[model samples]
Target: MKILIVGPSWVGDMVMSQSLYKRLLELHPNVLIDVLAPAWCKPILERMPEVNQAIEMPLGHGQFSLSQRWMLGKSLRDNHYDHAYILPNSAKSALIPLFAKVPKRTGWKGEMRYGLLNDLRPNRKIFQFMVERYVALAHSKSTMLSEVTIDDIPNPALNVDNENQLACLQRFNISPDLPIVGLCPGAEFGPAKRWPEQHYAYIAKQLITEGHQVCLFGGPKDKSVTEKIVKALSEHQKSMCFDLAGETSLVDAVDLLAACHTVFSNDSGLMHVAAAVNANIVAIYGSSSPMYTPPLSQKVRVVDTDINCRPCFKRECPLGHLKCLNELMPAKVLDAYRDLNRNQNLE
Candidate 1:
């Protein structure tokens, strides 16, 4: 079987999409799967062993360039894929596969995509995990199987290269002498999801004082926030903190994160990337809930509070005060980190 998967745009969603690819592989061991996603996600899809190839989606998200879609579709005619799974709910995301003339197009009922998807699956009961919803579309509409009903669903496991990890470390002038604690302090979604920077500096100080090396992680956009975290620290603490927010590429970040003993992150894309690489992780949640998109790793400790206004699911907090994250405090995450360390040692 030859399948073309229209992957989700976000880093976390694309990582979780591996469950669907793995499911397809299990059903057809000799199947060939190719993912069409944003160019930024190419590095991630490259690490999933089940994928046969990665096709870069030339157009940006929400872009409806009919001529470009038609041109790209025309280019793929010879491959003759058997199936196409549209991971995104937008009507625009379905256009390529339709233009490609794939026989079976599968997706959830979304955005009035009436005839766009021939094999449509309705999300009647809201799925608990985003992975669950993505995995369900791997089956036909009639079979109706999903991760919710399945046993032993595989979590995303990104393949790591030791050589690359070594190179990344050397490029950054980093040493493995001390235990590494990676701090991912930026949330691309919005500030509502971001824990206070003062809280992060406190964690960084505590870790550095304990003789652990702390590295801050984020994309180019997060460099300022990461800088704030580093600047607030003591000179010695700042020396221990490696600010690589804008310095490294996503693939480089993945390799560097693989060398870490533990990671502390807000509910963000790098959090999921950290999880996929099997980093010992403590994922902090503020506006988001773990039930929907928890980091897919066994070694993770999710730190969230039972605040009434939490899990708002908005890009930014509607209420001016983000008490959900502010009141959760640094001590709670520190306690979770300590427990995770104890468990890892016992193991």
Candidate 2:
């Protein structure tokens, strides 16, 4: 069997969608799976062993150029894909599969995509976790959705590039002599999802004091956020802290993250990437809830405040106060890290 998957746009969602690819390979051992995703996702898709190829999407996210979609889809006809799994819920996302004339096209129901998707799953929310929803599509439409458990959805495990990992460590002058603590304090969603910079700086300082080196990680948009955290740290702490937020590429960041002893992050892309790499993770949740999208890693600690208005899932806080994140003190995160460390030692 041959398959074509229209992958998710966001880094985290793209990473999580690996579960679906993995499930497909298990069901059909010899199946060839190719993913159609944004150029940004190429670095991530390359890490997945199940993917046969990573085809770049010409049209940008939210771009609805009918001519472009038709041409791109027409171009794929020669590949003779037997099936296509559209991960995004939008009607536009399903166009390529239809235009390509794939025998079967599957996806969750959303936004006037009735004719676009042939094997539509009506209730995506039935599967609580995003990974569950993706993996469920791999099963036949005749199968009951409720029968699929969390265990059925495989955790995404990205293959580390050891050569690139070494090059990044040398380029950044990061030594493995001290235990490395990676801090991912950026959330692409918005301010509501982000933990305070001061809190992150406090954590970095405390970890450094305990003889661990800290590496700040994020995309270019998050450079300011990481800079603020660095600014709050003392010169001595600054020397011990390496702010590589905007410095490293996504692929390079993944390599470096795999080398960390532990990773502390907000509910963001890097958090999911850290989990995929099998790093010890301290995931801090604010506007988002872990119940919906927890880290898939076994070695993970989820830190969140029990606030009434939290999990609002808003870009910015609807209310003036951001108690969900603000009230979540740095000490609480450190405590969670300690607890996770203890559990690992016990095991």
Candidate 3:
């Protein structure tokens, strides 16, 4: 069977969707899986062993012009796919699959896609995590969603090779023998999700004092924040910190992160990557609730204070205090790191 998966656009969502792709492969090992995703996420999809090829979807804004959609649909029709799984909820997300005239189109019953999806599934409330929701779609209506577990999902792996990891580290002058700690301080969501810069600096300093080198990771937009974090650290701590924010590509960031002993990050793409790599991860959640989208790895340790107004799901704190994140002291984070390190040493 040939399957075409309509992938989610967001980086983290794309990673989470891998769970569904994995389950499909497990059920039908002989099946060939192809993904339709944005150009930027091609590297991530290409890395997955289950994915045979990633078709780049050219999109501008939420809507793809009728002409563009027709062209894309034509291209997909030529592939002669047997089935298409639409991951995104938008009505437009189903256009290509419908136009391609795939034998079977599957997705949730939303966006009023009456004629688009031939096998529409009811959006059940049994699955708590978004990843689980994505995976449950693969099963028949009689399948029990409650029985789905993390074991059913495919673990995250980088498409980049080991040689690339070593080469990237060498190019960055990072020594292999020295223990590395990764810090991801940016959240594309908004300021509400961000922990204070001072707290990040404090954690960096603590890690350095404990003899670990720190690497700051984020996009070019976060360069200013990274510089401030480095400046806040004491001279001794600063010496051990490397500001590679905006310097490394997403593929390169994953490779470098794979080399780290642990990663401390807000709920972001890198955090998901760290979990996929099975790195010891300290995931800090703010406006976002852990219950809905916690890291999908056993090695992850999530920290979230039970603030009454938390998990508002807002981009910015409705109350301005941002206490859910700000109240989570640096000491607590440091303590978690120490505990993780001790546990790893015992193993």
TM-score of 3: 0.96
**lDDT of candidate 1 over 143-174, digit per residue (tens):** 65533443456789888888998888878778
lDDT assessment of candidate 2: 0.92
lDDT of each: 0.88, 0.92, 0.84
Best-fitting candidate, scored by lDDT: 2
Could you tell me which residue pairs clash in candidate 2? none
Error of 2 at 288 (Å): 0.8
Better of 2 and 3 by TM-score: 2
Rank by lDDT, descending? 2, 1, 3
247-283 per-residue lDDT for model 2 (tens digits): 9999999999999979999999999999999899999
TM-scores, in order shown? 0.97, 0.98, 0.96
Q: Please give the ranking of all candidate structures by TM-score, highest first, separated by commas.
A: 2, 1, 3
Better of 1 and 3 by lDDT: 1
Worst 10 residues of 3 by lDDT: 144-153
RMSD of each: 1.3, 0.9, 1.5
